[model samples]
Target: MAAPVCLEYRIEGNDFMVAGAASNNIKNTLKMLGISSSVCTRVAIIAYEAEINLVIHGGGGVLKAEITEDRVKLTAEDEGPGIADIEKAMTEGFSTATEYAREMGFGAGMGLPNIKKNSDEFNIESEVGKGTRLYSTVFFNKQ
Candidate 1:
Protein backbone atom coordinates (compact mmCIF):
# COMPACT_ATOMS: atom_id res chain seq x y z
CA MET A 1 0.00 0.00 0.00
CA ALA A 2 1.03 3.60 -0.55
CA ALA A 3 0.22 6.92 1.05
CA PRO A 4 -3.34 8.13 0.59
CA VAL A 5 -4.20 10.08 -2.54
CA CYS A 6 -5.92 13.42 -2.09
CA LEU A 7 -8.32 15.04 -4.56
CA GLU A 8 -10.18 18.32 -4.30
CA TYR A 9 -13.00 19.89 -6.30
CA ARG A 10 -15.11 23.05 -6.20
CA ILE A 11 -18.87 22.88 -6.54
CA GLU A 12 -20.83 25.87 -7.72
CA GLY A 13 -24.15 26.82 -6.19
CA ASN A 14 -27.35 26.45 -8.23
CA ASP A 15 -25.43 24.84 -11.00
CA PHE A 16 -27.55 21.80 -11.43
CA MET A 17 -26.13 20.81 -14.78
CA VAL A 18 -22.61 20.54 -13.49
CA ALA A 19 -23.43 19.15 -10.10
CA GLY A 20 -22.28 15.58 -10.66
CA ALA A 21 -19.08 16.42 -12.45
CA ALA A 22 -16.83 16.13 -9.44
CA SER A 23 -18.15 12.77 -8.43
CA ASN A 24 -17.82 11.53 -11.98
CA ASN A 25 -14.23 12.66 -12.09
CA ILE A 26 -13.48 10.95 -8.82
CA LYS A 27 -15.06 7.75 -10.11
CA ASN A 28 -12.97 7.87 -13.23
CA THR A 29 -9.80 8.54 -11.28
CA LEU A 30 -10.45 5.66 -8.95
CA LYS A 31 -11.16 3.36 -11.86
CA MET A 32 -7.93 4.38 -13.54
CA LEU A 33 -6.08 3.64 -10.32
CA GLY A 34 -7.55 0.10 -10.37
CA ILE A 35 -9.84 0.54 -7.38
CA SER A 36 -12.46 -2.16 -6.96
CA SER A 37 -15.74 -1.70 -8.82
CA SER A 38 -17.80 -1.89 -5.67
CA VAL A 39 -15.73 0.72 -3.91
CA CYS A 40 -15.90 2.99 -6.92
CA THR A 41 -19.67 2.64 -7.10
CA ARG A 42 -20.09 3.52 -3.45
CA VAL A 43 -17.84 6.51 -3.80
CA ALA A 44 -19.66 7.65 -6.91
CA ILE A 45 -23.08 7.40 -5.32
CA ILE A 46 -22.19 9.23 -2.11
CA ALA A 47 -20.07 11.80 -3.83
CA TYR A 48 -22.83 12.54 -6.33
CA GLU A 49 -25.36 12.99 -3.56
CA ALA A 50 -23.00 15.29 -1.68
CA GLU A 51 -22.23 17.26 -4.80
CA ILE A 52 -25.90 17.76 -5.60
CA ASN A 53 -26.62 18.80 -2.06
CA LEU A 54 -23.93 21.44 -2.36
CA VAL A 55 -25.54 22.75 -5.53
CA ILE A 56 -29.13 22.72 -4.35
CA HIS A 57 -28.79 23.37 -0.62
CA GLY A 58 -25.37 24.89 -0.22
CA GLY A 59 -24.64 28.31 -1.73
CA GLY A 60 -21.43 26.79 -3.01
CA GLY A 61 -18.87 24.47 -1.55
CA VAL A 62 -15.62 22.60 -1.72
CA LEU A 63 -15.27 18.85 -1.84
CA LYS A 64 -12.16 17.10 -0.61
CA ALA A 65 -11.54 13.41 -1.16
CA GLU A 66 -8.78 11.44 0.50
CA ILE A 67 -8.25 7.94 -0.80
CA THR A 68 -6.30 5.77 1.55
CA GLU A 69 -5.32 2.16 1.10
CA ASP A 70 -8.24 0.98 3.16
CA ARG A 71 -10.78 3.78 2.95
CA VAL A 72 -11.92 6.97 1.30
CA LYS A 73 -12.77 10.18 3.11
CA LEU A 74 -15.14 12.80 1.68
CA THR A 75 -15.74 16.24 3.10
CA ALA A 76 -18.10 18.95 1.86
CA GLU A 77 -18.04 22.53 3.10
CA ASP A 78 -20.45 25.25 2.06
CA GLU A 79 -21.43 28.87 2.71
CA GLY A 80 -25.18 28.54 2.42
CA PRO A 81 -27.81 28.84 5.09
CA GLY A 82 -27.33 25.95 7.45
CA ILE A 83 -29.84 23.35 8.45
CA ALA A 84 -32.10 24.53 11.27
CA ASP A 85 -33.03 21.12 12.59
CA ILE A 86 -30.49 18.56 11.67
CA GLU A 87 -32.48 15.74 13.18
CA LYS A 88 -35.52 16.60 11.09
CA ALA A 89 -33.39 17.23 8.07
CA MET A 90 -32.03 13.75 8.41
CA THR A 91 -35.52 12.38 8.12
CA GLU A 92 -36.62 11.00 4.77
CA GLY A 93 -39.20 13.61 3.81
CA PHE A 94 -38.05 16.85 5.42
CA SER A 95 -36.61 19.47 3.13
CA THR A 96 -35.92 23.19 2.94
CA ALA A 97 -35.49 23.30 -0.78
CA THR A 98 -37.06 25.96 -2.92
CA GLU A 99 -39.90 25.47 -5.36
CA TYR A 100 -37.44 25.67 -8.20
CA ALA A 101 -35.32 22.96 -6.67
CA ARG A 102 -38.33 20.79 -6.10
CA GLU A 103 -39.47 21.35 -9.64
CA MET A 104 -36.08 20.19 -10.76
CA GLY A 105 -36.77 16.90 -9.00
CA PHE A 106 -34.26 17.46 -6.25
CA GLY A 107 -34.73 18.49 -2.59
CA ALA A 108 -36.73 15.35 -1.87
CA GLY A 109 -34.85 15.37 1.43
CA MET A 110 -33.05 12.14 0.69
CA GLY A 111 -29.61 13.59 0.15
CA LEU A 112 -28.41 13.39 3.74
CA PRO A 113 -29.92 10.03 4.42
CA ASN A 114 -28.51 8.57 1.24
CA ILE A 115 -25.10 9.96 2.08
CA LYS A 116 -25.26 8.45 5.54
CA LYS A 117 -26.38 5.11 4.19
CA ASN A 118 -23.60 4.86 1.63
CA SER A 119 -20.83 5.90 3.95
CA ASP A 120 -19.31 3.88 6.73
CA GLU A 121 -19.13 6.98 8.92
CA PHE A 122 -20.93 10.30 8.66
CA ASN A 123 -20.87 13.61 10.50
CA ILE A 124 -22.49 16.96 9.85
CA GLU A 125 -22.18 20.41 11.43
CA SER A 126 -24.03 23.58 10.57
CA GLU A 127 -24.68 27.11 11.76
CA VAL A 128 -27.90 28.87 10.77
CA GLY A 129 -26.21 31.83 9.14
CA LYS A 130 -22.64 30.73 8.76
CA GLY A 131 -22.59 27.52 6.69
CA THR A 132 -22.52 23.73 6.77
CA ARG A 133 -19.91 21.03 6.69
CA LEU A 134 -20.35 17.30 6.15
CA TYR A 135 -17.88 14.48 6.48
CA SER A 136 -18.18 10.90 5.33
CA THR A 137 -15.84 7.95 5.15
CA VAL A 138 -16.27 4.67 3.27
CA PHE A 139 -14.10 1.66 3.94
CA PHE A 140 -12.87 -0.37 1.00
CA ASN A 141 -13.32 -3.65 2.82
CA LYS A 142 -16.96 -2.87 3.44
CA GLN A 143 -17.52 -2.14 -0.20
Candidate 2:
Protein backbone atom coordinates (compact mmCIF):
# COMPACT_ATOMS: atom_id res chain seq x y z
CA MET A 1 0.00 0.00 0.00
CA ALA A 2 1.22 3.54 -0.72
CA ALA A 3 1.58 6.21 1.91
CA PRO A 4 -1.15 8.80 2.00
CA VAL A 5 -0.61 11.98 -0.02
CA CYS A 6 -1.74 15.51 0.68
CA LEU A 7 -1.68 18.73 -1.37
CA GLU A 8 -2.59 22.30 -0.48
CA TYR A 9 -3.47 25.35 -2.54
CA ARG A 10 -4.04 29.00 -1.73
CA ILE A 11 -6.82 30.59 -3.73
CA GLU A 12 -6.88 34.33 -4.29
CA GLY A 13 -9.95 36.50 -4.54
CA ASN A 14 -11.09 37.34 -8.04
CA ASP A 15 -8.12 35.55 -9.53
CA PHE A 16 -9.58 34.01 -12.61
CA MET A 17 -6.17 33.49 -14.14
CA VAL A 18 -5.27 30.84 -11.59
CA ALA A 19 -8.67 29.55 -10.56
CA GLY A 20 -8.18 26.11 -12.05
CA ALA A 21 -4.53 25.78 -11.04
CA ALA A 22 -5.18 23.74 -7.92
CA SER A 23 -7.52 21.37 -9.71
CA ASN A 24 -4.96 20.84 -12.44
CA ASN A 25 -2.31 20.09 -9.89
CA ILE A 26 -4.52 17.54 -8.17
CA LYS A 27 -5.33 15.87 -11.48
CA ASN A 28 -1.63 15.53 -12.23
CA THR A 29 -0.93 14.20 -8.78
CA LEU A 30 -3.67 11.61 -9.10
CA LYS A 31 -2.25 10.54 -12.43
CA MET A 32 1.19 10.14 -10.88
CA LEU A 33 -0.33 8.14 -8.04
CA GLY A 34 -1.93 5.80 -10.58
CA ILE A 35 -5.46 6.70 -9.58
CA SER A 36 -7.95 5.59 -12.20
CA SER A 37 -8.50 8.10 -14.97
CA SER A 38 -12.22 8.09 -14.31
CA VAL A 39 -11.64 8.89 -10.64
CA CYS A 40 -9.11 11.53 -11.59
CA THR A 41 -11.65 13.18 -13.89
CA ARG A 42 -14.26 13.34 -11.12
CA VAL A 43 -11.76 14.76 -8.66
CA ALA A 44 -10.66 17.33 -11.20
CA ILE A 45 -14.19 18.55 -11.67
CA ILE A 46 -14.87 18.69 -7.94
CA ALA A 47 -11.61 20.52 -7.21
CA TYR A 48 -12.06 22.99 -10.03
CA GLU A 49 -15.58 23.94 -9.01
CA ALA A 50 -14.63 24.43 -5.37
CA GLU A 51 -11.54 26.43 -6.30
CA ILE A 52 -13.64 28.70 -8.46
CA ASN A 53 -16.11 29.26 -5.65
CA LEU A 54 -13.27 30.35 -3.41
CA VAL A 55 -12.01 32.71 -6.08
CA ILE A 56 -15.36 34.19 -7.08
CA HIS A 57 -17.18 34.15 -3.76
CA GLY A 58 -14.97 33.26 -0.82
CA GLY A 59 -12.57 36.19 -1.30
CA GLY A 60 -9.63 33.93 -0.43
CA GLY A 61 -9.11 30.49 1.02
CA VAL A 62 -7.14 27.31 1.26
CA LEU A 63 -7.91 24.17 -0.67
CA LYS A 64 -6.61 20.85 0.54
CA ALA A 65 -6.53 17.41 -1.03
CA GLU A 66 -5.83 14.20 0.85
CA ILE A 67 -5.32 11.00 -1.03
CA THR A 68 -5.40 7.50 0.44
CA GLU A 69 -5.84 3.99 -0.83
CA ASP A 70 -9.55 4.07 -0.25
CA ARG A 71 -10.54 7.56 -1.20
CA VAL A 72 -9.63 11.16 -1.99
CA LYS A 73 -10.87 13.92 0.29
CA LEU A 74 -11.12 17.61 -0.52
CA THR A 75 -11.70 20.60 1.71
CA ALA A 76 -12.09 24.28 0.93
CA GLU A 77 -11.89 26.92 3.65
CA ASP A 78 -12.36 30.53 2.71
CA GLU A 79 -12.05 33.91 4.44
CA GLY A 80 -14.60 35.84 2.47
CA PRO A 81 -18.20 36.75 3.03
CA GLY A 82 -19.84 33.51 3.98
CA ILE A 83 -22.93 32.14 2.39
CA ALA A 84 -26.08 33.68 3.79
CA ASP A 85 -28.44 30.87 2.97
CA ILE A 86 -27.18 27.37 2.56
CA GLU A 87 -30.26 26.05 0.83
CA LYS A 88 -30.49 29.01 -1.50
CA ALA A 89 -26.80 28.81 -2.30
CA MET A 90 -27.12 25.20 -3.31
CA THR A 91 -29.75 25.96 -5.86
CA GLU A 92 -28.57 25.89 -9.44
CA GLY A 93 -28.26 29.23 -11.27
CA PHE A 94 -28.23 31.21 -8.03
CA SER A 95 -25.05 33.19 -7.65
CA THR A 96 -23.84 36.37 -6.05
CA ALA A 97 -20.73 36.66 -8.18
CA THR A 98 -19.46 40.09 -8.98
CA GLU A 99 -19.81 41.57 -12.42
CA TYR A 100 -16.17 40.91 -13.08
CA ALA A 101 -16.58 37.25 -12.22
CA ARG A 102 -19.54 37.00 -14.56
CA GLU A 103 -17.49 38.65 -17.26
CA MET A 104 -14.92 35.92 -16.86
CA GLY A 105 -17.53 33.37 -17.94
CA PHE A 106 -17.64 32.06 -14.40
CA GLY A 107 -20.30 32.77 -11.71
CA ALA A 108 -22.82 30.81 -13.67
CA GLY A 109 -24.00 29.42 -10.33
CA MET A 110 -22.79 25.97 -11.24
CA GLY A 111 -19.78 25.66 -8.99
CA LEU A 112 -21.40 24.26 -5.85
CA PRO A 113 -23.96 22.22 -7.70
CA ASN A 114 -21.27 20.64 -9.79
CA ILE A 115 -19.19 19.95 -6.74
CA LYS A 116 -22.08 18.18 -5.06
CA LYS A 117 -22.84 16.22 -8.17
CA ASN A 118 -19.36 14.78 -8.48
CA SER A 119 -18.49 13.98 -4.89
CA ASP A 120 -19.46 10.79 -3.12
CA GLU A 121 -19.79 12.72 0.10
CA PHE A 122 -20.49 16.42 0.43
CA ASN A 123 -20.95 18.84 3.32
CA ILE A 124 -20.80 22.61 3.62
CA GLU A 125 -20.97 25.09 6.49
CA SER A 126 -21.10 28.86 6.28
CA GLU A 127 -21.61 31.87 8.51
CA VAL A 128 -22.81 35.08 6.95
CA GLY A 129 -19.97 37.26 8.21
CA LYS A 130 -17.38 34.65 9.05
CA GLY A 131 -16.48 32.21 6.29
CA THR A 132 -17.47 29.05 4.50
CA ARG A 133 -15.95 25.60 4.68
CA LEU A 134 -16.67 22.80 2.27
CA TYR A 135 -15.91 19.09 2.65
CA SER A 136 -16.15 16.48 -0.05
CA THR A 137 -14.82 13.00 -0.65
CA VAL A 138 -14.55 10.74 -3.67
CA PHE A 139 -14.07 7.06 -3.13
CA PHE A 140 -11.80 4.92 -5.29
CA ASN A 141 -14.00 1.86 -5.05
CA LYS A 142 -17.29 2.53 -6.80
CA GLN A 143 -19.04 -0.59 -5.53
Which one is best on lDDT? 2
lDDT of 1 by residue, 32-115 (tens): 878899888988988998899889988889998998878889999998999888999999978888999899888888888888
Minimal lDDT window, size 10, model 2 = 134-143
Q: lDDT per residue, candidate 2, 1-143, as tens digits?
A: 36889999989988888779998999999998888999999999999999888888889799999998889999999978898899999999998888888888987887888899999999999998899999999998632
| Model 2 per-residue lDDT at 94 | 94
lDDT of each: 0.89, 0.90
CA lDDT of 127 in candidate 2?
92
RMSD of 2: 1.7
The candidate 1 region of ten consecutive residues with least summed lDDT is: 134-143
The numbered model that scores best in TM-score is 2
**Model 2 local distance difference test score:** 0.90
Once superposed on the true structure, which residue ranges of model 2 sit more than 4 Å away at CA?
none
State each candidate's clash count.
Answer: 0, 0
Error of 1 at 127 (Å): 0.9
